[model samples]
Target: MQDRFLADVLANRHNRAILERWDDLALPDAWLVAGCLFQTVWNLQSGRPPEADIKDYDLFYFDAGDLSEAGERAVQARVDALLGDLGVCIEASNQARVHLWYESYFGHPYAPLHSSRHGIERFLVPSTCVGVRPGEVCAPYGLALLYDGVLGMNPLVPHRDLFERKAASYRARWPWLRMAADAATPHPAA
Candidate 1:
């Protein structure tokens, strides 16, 4: 199932192009993660267009040495230049630096992480934890939730409020998605 999901992702023209550009950049432990991955699968499962409603492509890397905003900005600029022509939003973040600003940005405490995979493990929802780089796909929390059509909380460090809000938005866009009771708190779609 993982192989099939990955194959479907690779078959997406936009995903393929983004992964190619990401590989060319050669960012340390880089992976095209988040919405662009799982959302594509969701679209497939729901019989929607492959790129339907996908908001952005997330590019995550681990660069603990330089966690400053300026350093990330420079990388973001490079990524923008590389993928801007693709006509989609490409969001790049240094996972090693997320803890530095996560609390201020999301109003929640996020522990410092050791690697990119550690960052993936902390995603608000289990199904969104998948990522793909040049040669491999990584799903630290496994793909069962995604394949089973279940939306589960991250047992490692669940963020109920944020998960509820995000899940509401996802549900609004894809009504067929099911939210686990733990993450099913009602919220307006953003």
Candidate 2:
């Protein structure tokens, strides 16, 4: 499963380019994350080009020592300079600082994250929660739901309204993706 998923994500040339040059960025514990990884696989499974409908690349890094907005902007500037020519937006976020602004922006309180992986775990859909860096893939929840095109609310972030909004956006693009009604009932953590 890991090998196949790796191959699927790398099929997007921009993902490949970013991973190849990832060492150039000095951000700590950084991982290329979220929509860019899952959506590329979705696009491929739908027989569309791997890069189709990809809005931006998300890069998550943990910098607890410097949680200021300016610190995040500095990292983003570095990301832009390195990957700007790719002609796609690359958004770099400091996972450590999410708690400071999350409640105001997303209207939900987010506790401080211990690591970038912790932040990844809070994504609205477990199947869509994934991250990658050179030589590594961080998918705590396996790929079955993603491969099956199943959309379920993530237990870690079980907000009905937010999940509905997010799932609707995804289903809008890939009408074939199925939403499991029972998935909202909490189960033991995966």
Candidate 3:
């Protein structure tokens, strides 16, 4: 099932374009992650347009060698220049520096991460926890939840309030989506 979804995502012109540009940039441990990857699949599952209601394209990379805010901004500027024509917001964040400002920004204590994938693992929802690199999709939380159309929580760092709020937003857009019982609890298979 994941393979099928991966093929579909790879076939998408928007995704392919983004992936190509991301590859061209060649950022260290870079990935086209989050909504832009999984939401396309959700739209497919619900028979909606592939790019419908996607908020942004998240590009994450780990550059521990230069964990300064200016360093991340420089990379972000480069990304903006590369993907500015896409007509969608492209958010680039350095995983190495997330812990420095995460608490101030989100009111939570985010532990220092080792790599880009470590940051992916802390996503609020299981379905949104997927990332795409040059040739593969990485889902540390497993793809079964996404394959079964179940919205599960990351037991490692469950943020129930944010999950419910985001679920409401998603439900409003994709009415077919079902919410889990609680933030810390994984939903039953669909």
Name the lDDT of candidate 2. 0.88
lDDT of 1 by residue, 1-190 (tens): 7788788787667999987666567689888888888888888888888899888888889999999999999999998888889999988899999999989999989899988888876788877888888778788767777766667667666677888898888888778888777544222112
Q: Which of candidates 1 and 2 is the stronger one according to TM-score?
A: 2
Model 1: residues >4 Å from true position, as ranges?
A: 181-190
State, as a TM-score between 0 and 1, how close model 1 is to the true structure.
Answer: 0.91
The TM-score leader among the candidates is: 2
- Candidate 1, poorest ten consecutive residues by summed lDDT: 181-190
Candidate 3: misplaced stretches above 4 Å? 181-190
Tell me the tens digit of each residue's lDDT in model 3 across 122-184.
888776788887777788767766665666556766677777777787777777776555454
Ranking by lDDT: 2, 1, 3
lDDT (C-alpha) at residue 163 in model 3: 70
TM-scores for candidates 1 onward, in order: 0.91, 0.95, 0.89
Clashing pairs in 3: none
Instruction: Give the clashing residue pairs of candidate 2, or none.
Output: none
Best by lDDT: 2
In order of TM-score, best first, we have: 2, 1, 3
Which scores better on lDDT, 1 or 3?
A: 1
Candidate 2: regions farther than 4 A off:
182-190
